[model samples]
Target: MKVTFPHMGNMSIVIKALLKELNIEFIPPPPITKRTLSLGVQHAPESACLPLKINIGNFLEAAEKGADTVLMAGGIGPCRFGYYNQVQREILNDLGVNLNMIVLEPPDNHIGELLKRLRTLTGSNSWWRVVKAIRFAFAKCEALDDLERAASRIRCRELQRGDVDRVYAQGCQAIDQATTPKEIVQCRDEYLTKMRSLPLDHLKRPIRIGIVGEIYTLLEPSSNGFMEKNLGRLGAEVSRSIYLSEWVNEHLLKGLLPVKGHKLTRKRAQPYLNCMVGGHGQESIGATIEYAQQGYDGVIQVGPLTCMPEIVAQSIMPNVEKDFHIPVLTIYVDEQTGEAGLMTRLEAFVDMLERRKRIQVESGLQG
Candidate 1:
């Protein structure tokens, strides 16, 4: 079966690695662009969330390219993400697209079911081979995450405009090309070294911002108007709470391995939000608290217009702001979101942050 999946930041790269090792044919959807968004907006229900619309667009495009099987992740939460697969399946079927859709649910307590689903894709591949492929793919995933983290740091301070972007583009290409674990490690290190070598202003302490929101909007640059890159270009260091590797470690690997921080996240979120309000709502509150405790300059929350989880998080943010004294900007985005408007809001927020920092410094000096 020629398998296809929707794009979620660097997730496509990891999926490509996994499918390649499984010896399965993969038909990746075209890079997201205006056309993709337009197609999604044109067909999706008026009230559907942004991610669902984009995903529908992705599957439609992939189906046109002869993908017979679609692989989608399933969720178990009050968030609508839990119903995406069934909803999209109905949508595609109504549009007369004939494709086998597989939804891989999180293996919270059903590891065997998850393994069975995986085996269906691998076909005749031996158990050991499947294990090796998974390990290799995860290795690539970790490497990609490391490179991205470095890029965020380098982007703000690079002496040459776009140098970090250029190197990062090349690094993604290099990582995509590497097939072996050793090659992946080598490529990652080389890119890390290159990023470090880029001429940077040693004395420029950039405004540091933490990004927390719904997973899809937080991770997908196109969905969020490339906010991380834009923040860096505007001379701010951006740290996101969600990374694909970390998600995998927490959701998929936690059953097999002992993973930390989930409890800590819940504990930190206790004051403002004590329970899982569905989706990443609790995580958003927890991450914002963590960032505030870590003394970040500000936090930006981005999510689809109707995302319930983020809506819940957004309502609680005012209390978070008051208690933590960290400025928080919540941007609700959708197909109608305009770049110009987003840029203006971002610029004003950055200016405010800079003024706040300067005022604090002056007050300290006077004291």
Candidate 2:
């Protein structure tokens, strides 16, 4: 059975590694584009969030490429994401697509069920082989995150625009091709050194900006209009609140291991929001506070239009800005979100941040 899955930043890399080890043939959905979004928009409910619509488009594209099975992650929360798999499945059935969809839920208290699902997918592959594949794939993901973090740090400092991005892309490509953990480490280090050695404009002081919001929009560039790279190009260093491996380590393995479960972040949010508003809402508030205390110039909260959790976070952000003395910009994206408009807003935000920094320096309030 050929398998397929939605794209979420570097997640496809890990999925590929796993399927290859299991000796399973898989069809990866094509990259996100205008046509992909169009296809999704044509069929999805008008009120559905952008990520869900894009997912439907992804599965349709894969189905066209001869994929018969889809692999998706399941959720349980007040967020609409919890019902996405079932809704999408029903939608596909209505469209007469004969694909079998598999949903992998977090093993919160269902370790035995999770293992049974794994066995079904892996067929007769020994548990040892499956475990080894997961380790290798996870190593690749961790290495990629390191590369991404380095890129974010250096993007605004590079003497030449896009130089850091170019190196970062090459590093990701190398990691994706590396077969062994040693080689993965080599890829990360070799490219990291290269990134550090690139010429930098030391005279330029970049505005420090933290990004906080829904996981899908934060991780998926196409959904967020490539906000991180665009902000860096506008002379801001971007720090994201979430990454793939960290999510898996905390949520996916929570049942199997002892995880802190972002205790510090939750603690920071206690003053403003103490309960789970679902779908990273509390985390977004916590992360913004964390960034403010760290002296960041500003924070941008991005998410899909009509997301209730993000709406709640957005409502509370004015308080965060007032209490922390940091600027906050909320951008809610949909099929109609224009890249030009998004860039314009980012430019204005960065300009304001720079002016604020200048004032602080002149008044002897900042070093």
The 0-to-1 C-alpha lDDT of every candidate, in the order given, reads 0.88, 0.88
Candidate 1 achieves a global lDDT of: 0.88
Cα RMSD for candidate 1?
1.3
Q: Estimate each model's TM-score.
A: 0.97, 0.96
Segments of candidate 2 deviating more than 4 angstroms: 255-261, 365-367
Report the C-alpha lDDT of model 1 over 43-132, residue by residue, as the tens digit.
889898999999988988998899999999988879999998999888888889987888888877766667788877889998889888
TM-score of 1: 0.97
In candidate 2 the C-alpha lDDT for residue 341 amounts to: 95
